[model samples]
Target: MAGSAHGDIPLTTISFSQRPNGTVATVTVSNPRKLNSLNTTVLDAFLSCVPPLAQRSDLRCVIVTGGLCSVGQQAFIGGADISEMKDFSNAEAGRTFINKLHLACKALRNLPVPVIARVNGHALGGGLVVMASADLRIATSDARFGMPEVQRGVPSTIEAAMLPAQIGAARARRLLLLGDTISAQEAESWGLVDKVVQADQLDEAVEEWVDRLLKNGPRALRIQKKLFAMWEQVPLREAIEAGVWEFGTPFEAEGFEAEGRRMMNEFQMQNRQRKSRL
Candidate 1:
């Protein structure tokens, strides 16, 4: 695990760690005592981690996992800290918090590599948003997923917006409006989580998925990620134009041209050898 400390942030609510897995990096969130609630400190620490990650050519995938320290063998994160809500009496304070939250989510979404959520336990409220923002989500059978914000007297702002896009609008409302928690299995059924594994098998499941991702050509994955980010904003032709330039421009650049060509040649050679044997 690797990270530079961010001691300047006043809130001690978030901790960061970087664990290298071949070409993939795993950034863990360990604030179990606080149910992994995100405050200003946590957001700052996360923001500090993003830029360096984006610049790494070796990175192919990323996984974000939550810490579990609460009662029962359940949940990755219970929810955000309601106590922190006491300070937001006016619109300005609420707007500031929301903006920070939006930027942090955007940073995760904009990551050059695919980001997976390894949901070890319960993920609720803002924790759920983090999971949703990830490109893929894998949860343990015992894990519970939900947005209990309504129960705490607040609307599910960011999550409400993304959840509908992930699952259908109806299923998203069923969970958000009712504030009901669902098992990992049910979440997977509704497309909230991509997969659910036995508790003991969670780590292995995550590794297998990462292995599959790394097997693909890196440039292909990066191009796919760029297109995905643009799909919602631009028309088909414009999005294609944007993605082609976003992806192709880098290839013509000095270092990328050589490395990418070499990798493609190697991949073709491997395919040819395998086909010959077959």
Candidate 2:
């Protein structure tokens, strides 16, 4: 449980812990002063911490969550630190600041394995965009979500564009344009969050997702995730063609064909035994 500092940014900490089985990694974000907000310093630390985890050979899934609140409540990311935005006087400076945030989000999305947002508290503005970028999201019932950037005099950009694909254009507009925060149930109903549970059940819910993802073939899962991202940008016919290409990629990987043949043989054997028993 010993944590290390990222460079000299002691207040902003990113910790990673691998499960005993080595299939899952849990990344905890802690910045107690701002409810785990992503300031420039924190964005740097996050960019440094995530890319290596994404490249791990043994990793199958990732659970990203914020540090715990004092009362033992799970404090998921609050959003980008507004305090840091107050002094921005030029377009170039603003662009530089936003690019760092984009890099952090890109690292999470680029992970070959599924990245699950374990949302246990408020996820606003850029925080909501981070949740949107995850392959899957599970949240506590009390978790709140919004795109409040408009209220702060800034438009939600970067991965925030993923909102429409996540919750449909209409619902994405409600949050992005109106700056409305939705309850966890509402988020699920809108298809923003995949699952919602009680606060105490959050960890169990996340484990369930990790277990389910781990059950899939790792190469197939990686291909599927890659295609899913590609689908967002490509035309329908091209996307279908990409899927066909990915379908054949597993066979190109050594031993995949042999494994598939073995599994099919086992399935056929089981069917024959069942018929004989009948």
Candidate 3:
């Protein structure tokens, strides 16, 4: 993983492989050779990759990152290849482009299990939007994030409906209105990212995150995750009522309390056994 200066930018490409454990799927945005720009071809490849991997019951987490040697030199995705946009003219063309972008984002959002963005480098403009679709995101200290579409004479389209909820109005406005890049640390502060670690430590950190996530029961995690998602659309009171009726009432009236009692008793018995062994 040498630095990008050694004619490695074209090495910027995307690939996905499942780990031997079959629990985590790793998607690499290579082209540490080209900085992994998301042109139409790359986007099509990425969209194709996401669906099948997402359907796997064996998968608990997905780790997305850049190729080795990808550091401060280039972004995880630089942006849509500007050269590819030369033919855009009519409203229909613009709508089609935006539709593709929206579907790509939606695919990630709709993934049943968690997706972790192991951002290995800069993620600007459309790149940042792509990163934002992940459920959890860990950025390296050298990672850069922004939405500089305005700088390119384009409006921030797909994110027009999503960012405000994740980051709140003020922070979203600052990023979207200005179309500026922010340090990984700053992104964490604004609630756009989870944490920033040393560049060399990103892979280990992502694995650690997945380890923690795997400790939870899959069904419980799915229910709770959807619970949080439902909170966004309905009003607070209505959400609370719906949660009480749909989730809380069923669980509370079901085996949860009994399970808690049983678990506590089992834990006490285990403690006694350990003491006797001592």
lDDT of 1 by residue, 1-278 (tens): 33333432222222333334337777766554566667766666667775467888778888887655544455565666566766899988877886777776777788889999989888888778888888999999988888888887778986459788888998888888999889889999999999999989999999888889877767778878878888967799998778767665435646536545667778899999999999
- Compare the candidates by lDDT and give the number of the best one: 2
Over 26-95, each residue of candidate 2 has an lDDT whose tens digit, in order, gives: 7766666577777887777677778887677888888777775444344588888888888888998899
Question: How big is the positional error of residue 101 in model 1, measured in Å on the Cα after superposition?
Answer: 2.1
For residue 141, give model 1's deviation from the true position in Å.
0.7
Candidate 3 residue-wise lDDT, 1-278, digit = tens: 11123455343223444545347776655554446766555566567777676667777767776555344484566666566665788878777777776776777777777889888788877778878888899988988888777878878878556789888888788777898788988999988889899978987998888888776555445556666667877899988887676554324434545433444567899999999999
Alpha-carbon RMSD, each predicted model: 4.0, 3.2, 5.2
- Name the top TM-score candidate: 2
Steric clash pairs (candidate 1): 75-121, 75-122, 76-121, 76-122, 77-122
TM-score, prediction 2: 0.88
Give the winner by TM-score: 1 or 2. 2
Name the weakest run of 10 consecutive residues (lDDT summed) in model 1: 7-16
Model-by-model lDDT, in order? 0.75, 0.78, 0.70
Listed in order, each prediction's TM-score against the native is 0.82, 0.88, 0.79
Task: After the best TM-score superposition of candidate 3, give how far the Cα of residue 203 lies from its true spot, in angstroms.
Answer: 0.8
